[model samples]
Target: MSSDFYTTSILPFAGIIIKICRAYTDSQEDFEDYYQEVCLQIWRSREQFRGDSKWSTWIYRLSLNICLTLIKKKKNNRQHVVSEYQFVEDTEENQAFEDESLNQLYDAIKQLSEIDRAVILLYLEEKPNKDIAEIIGTTPNNIAVRVNRIKERLKKILDGKIN
Candidate 1:
């Protein structure tokens, strides 16, 4: 794929990259660094695209690989803790509390095995289990099974029932 093709296809997925990076990195600096690294990886791997899947699917797989690699490398050395964010403020009563819910969700996701989190993110994006499996190099049946387990585990963690 050409650079223009990669830019047009991958740039739109930057927000997803940011969300994944935020879940993996602690501080703003590390997040930015990781984000740039992801972009670089996407550029490097663009030529490997075969058009067998949607561009978004390809980008999602690329981003997941980059995030997992960075997490494994311990490249995010910052110690800051992010409190999470809300896309909107609908009411005054529980806005702050809602952010905590987001935080809890992210925390729970971060605690999952790297492959599991990638599955969850793709699932949340409404990707088919088969697509998720393809992205993570797993079987569709396995992806479905793991996703159910991950959801239940996330619920337990958010409810403070998981130690």
Candidate 2:
């Protein structure tokens, strides 16, 4: 991503990107990778922003698409070799919320389908059902039903009845 674009477009919304990446990834390493890819994707897809919705909403959509695609790619390429001389520029920005409930919630979320994860994250972010539907490419009624199902699944996972 271009430095100018990164500062102007991405820095302001870095927290949202971090939160979405946290929901999808298991490690700081994966988080960093997703963050960079999402940044690059946002720069590439900036032209698609027609301003129909808020800028943050567009970033959320892009982050979800890129992270999910990366997940698919990693799943498909299990035989890849490790790179030599890997350098990790560790920073204090990789924050794990210090609440057990939040941790457990994230763990349960990981058990959801890719789209379910996105829906739940937006729901947890307290986004309205209509907005969730719009972001996830579904109807508001569909988002409502799916939210209920996701709640049930999360309850099951929380109660130790399901893995």
Candidate 3:
């Protein structure tokens, strides 16, 4: 991957990428692998962006898809990185959500189904339900219903009613 493209194209929108990777990964190693693969994939496929959605939206969808693929591959006993990336040390912006409450919230989010994780992440990002539905390939009503159920599920998890 060209460093210029990464510095210009991918670096500006890395927060969303990092969040998606963090949501799906459990450890620093896996997080690094997933984060690297996501950056590589985005860098590799940058030309495919045809302006259908905002750049951030494309990054989110691509990041989620890559993470899910890596997860499935890991479940099947095959773990690999598509490409090795030279990582920059995380700046304070990337480390902004290190609070205990946020960690607990992320733990609860991990307990959700993969699709639900995507839904909740996007919802939390404050994307309207309609855009979320479009990205996740579901009806807006389905997104609304699922969002409500997911909130309740999260509440239950946090309250120790469900694990």
Ranking by lDDT: 3, 2, 1
Worst 10 residues of 3 by lDDT: 87-96
lDDT values for all models:
0.76, 0.87, 0.88
TM-score of model 3 vs. true structure: 0.84
lDDT per residue as tens, model 1, 1-163: 4678556866788777877777676556677888889788878887798999887778777777787777767746746656667243445432222566676677678788877788887887788998888888889999989999999988887788333
Tens-digit per-residue lDDT, 1-163, candidate 2: 6799999999999988887898899777898899989988899889989999999889888898888999999899878667887554443344366665777788789899999999999988888998888889989999999999999999988999335
TM-score list, all predictions: 0.75, 0.83, 0.84
Per candidate, the number of residue pairs that clash is: 0, 0, 0
What's model 3's lDDT at 39? 97
Candidate 1 vs 3: which has more lDDT = 3
After superposition, candidate 2 runs with Cα above 4 Å error: 2-4, 80-95, 161-163
Instruction: Supply the global lDDT for candidate 2.
Output: 0.87
Which numbered prediction scores highest in lDDT against the true structure? 3
Clashes of 1: 0
